[model samples]
Target chain A: MSQGEPGIELDTSLGYMLKAAASALHSAMEAVLSPLGMTITHYSCLELLAQRPGLSNSELARGAFVTRQSMNVLLQSLERQGLVIRPARAPVGRALPTELTDLGRRQLEVASAAVRRVEQNMLADLDTDEQDQMRRLLRTCITSITEPPASTT
Target chain B: MSQGEPGIELDTSLGYMLKAAASALHSAMEAVLSPLGMTITHYSCLELLAQRPGLSNSELARGAFVTRQSMNVLLQSLERQGLVIRPARAPVGRALPTELTDLGRRQLEVASAAVRRVEQNMLADLDTDEQDQMRRLLRTCITSITEPPASTT
Candidate 1:
């Protein structure tokens, strides 16, 4: 159906709107990042590693909202590019700790600028207040879903 | 950086927040839909087809925010499941038209209820006003990016 059709079949719930906006924004991001030979998923992993030097695979996967298997595949790809390095082993555990290499750091610098440009272009219509409100609402939603319930005691 | 770090390298932009929220919501959706043997991508395609019976592959891809190649793979899978039927030729053009089968409509009915539960859980915290505002802002963002500029006479 077209935009103004009566009784459109799609449910205009908050989740549906969020999914549509995210999908559109993701398409824009992929277009922007494609020239740099990075998918948004790759960039997200690298960005998280840049900020946190020695995150375990599970930790990174959790932060990136990807499954551990998917994260492992992404890590392997980054490693193959020599942009990320995994240390031999963690001091306290058997887990492998991943850190961005110097090349990866520089790449992040470039990717960050590209991402910022895309973000600005996407949000050009909203004033600062509206933007802030949107962010707060999203954060609240995320926290409510992710946090565990308090004990009844 | 840890949460207390003075300068954590977070993007904190509207696009970033939107992406993060969408990612989390999608993961939740996938978890709920997996037992029913459906990815969100597949469910989306089925949903659109159920609503509009004769959508072309390109039109479905555009509505679902996926590449034509990806859409082709998904359609093949759905057709194999006996949920979708693709005509060899369309009245308008050579491009094929696809519609949901009887099984597809029933699948969608079941999946829609599960999806609604996940969505309700996600939005359980927000009051009605917050939910409305969230939907309005997200719709505005989607429209701003997707809509072409007005023609200058």
Candidate 2:
């Protein structure tokens, strides 16, 4: 369909492509991780906490690119599963720092393998170079989109 | 951290990058489309139905990459909103076809503009060639990941 005029019709826009690829990968990951009683969001939260122990709730929310409210809900779910523990002492103006417990660590280990297997299948078609390129480009785009705008005088 | 090495290291993996980009875009699109009272899932269903006017329920599910069960739920919501209509007669073995109403078409027009604006802002940093390359690479990867494997001897 034309936008009020005739054109080549770029149906494969970057947004469409990104959404399609992500959706496909996400669906596959969900299928693989669901039996473990986790969603991609759940696995991501564990992955973040595993990598950065003692991150405040807000910090974790920022890293996860979700609203603080949403992150809190996820934290509650994780805490219930014994995958994470929040400290008693609260930060000055933020929620208390949270860390993974031994049980959480073990769960992370299992989840990591499941996730890596899914990633391998997803990237199987691409050789090393293409995979690297894909990662680099996506990283650049993510950074660009997430960055604050520069001052325009 | 090396493989099998533990404790809080940057993931810096392709899966992480892909997931982050997708999450960011999803959040951005959600914010933009929220004023219209539509989720990305809703917008996607409407778009597919718009392009293919007479799609059956299962076909719509496949086109939208959602399970039939989920599609049924979404269809119910859309039906409640009066944006979609389904015929009463059930064909031989197939469910009745679904199509968008006039209100759905108008809503889609508005949503399309909002989507395009957000997409433009998201891709502002990349040049045309880079955009093309990103789309091509993502398309290739998705096709590879979603395709059925060839039979092995």
Candidate 3:
């Protein structure tokens, strides 16, 4: 209960700041993406596909940080909208590789520009070196959490 | 569509890395919080109350980065469980200032300990200086995203 002990000071905690940054980024992305008839996850899916075509549903889900089941539903809707296509069967394993249609690509082009602007704007204050440092620090945090806990005797 | 131009490199994008770090932190917190019979947002609500005891529902919503509607639902549930209380009617304006009960404070003690461990584990690799740098950089990113976009010609 003491302020200096286990009590988390929301102002100075790196974890809280990280979440706040992410939340701000998420909100900014959504504000732009929503006007384009897409959610942040939806834009993420298209961006993933644009960068790496012929990705499976599960891979896309992982790339977009969403559940496969939810991505499956989204993919189905995209398929019906003629924005993407999947063969009737998986030509390889049980994983169907997905590709964006020409229309999807066109739509993504516009969305990508808007998103790029958002990201670039967010880094407006930080210089190139600072941006790199931020990335490294963030990656370290990710590793620390994902790795096993230190010995707790 | 060309690499090095408009195409975002997923492997190195700062935004993507930020999301990854947040996701990792979220999973770690959930792992610890779940066993304690709580979710991340639930723990966040209690923690916010512990630190600032009279946060209103809308204020908590903003602090926790959830919608007011969702936070209201959660608040009602917490009140029912006798973890928090709000006056029968708003003593000041329509906003009811919320306070944690003694039981709420007790539950938060356990949850806070668990969360602190997760946070400490996540910062194990970073030195003291780097942690401060991270906080500054993250606050910058948050500010960048929240501020209005620079004028584009």
Off by over 4 Å in 1: A1-11, A147-153, B2-11, B147-153
**DockQ of every model listed?**
0.42, 0.34, 0.54
For model 2 chain A, the run of ten residues with the poorest summed lDDT: A1-10
Model 2 agreement with the true structure over A47-145: per-residue lDDT tens digits: 887777788778888777678888889998889888899976686665688888899889888877877766777777788888777777887778766
* C-alpha lDDT of candidate 3 relative to the true structure: 0.87
How well does candidate 3 score on lDDT at residue A78? Answer: 88
> Tens digit of lDDT per residue, candidate 3, span B18-121?
99899889988998899888888899999999988778999899889999999999999999999999988887678888999999999999999888988999
DockQ measured for candidate 1:
0.42
lDDT of 2 by residue, B10-91 (tens): 5567766776888887887888789889888888788877776767778777656778889999998898889999987875
Residue A125: error of model 1 in Å?
A: 1.4
- What does the lDDT read for residue A152 in candidate 2? 29
Q: Can you list the residue pairs that collide in candidate 2?
A: A51-B8
**For this target, which candidate reaches the highest DockQ against the unseen true structure?**
3
Candidate 1 lDDT by residue in tens digits, B64-104: 77888899999999999999999765666566878899999
lDDT of 3 at B36: 83
Candidate 2 residue spans exceeding 4 A from truth: A1-11, A147-153, B1-11, B148-153
Which of the predicted structures, 2 or 3, would earn the higher lDDT when compared with the native?
3
With candidate 2 superimposed using the best TM-score fit, by how many Å does residue A73's alpha carbon deviate from the native?
Answer: 3.8
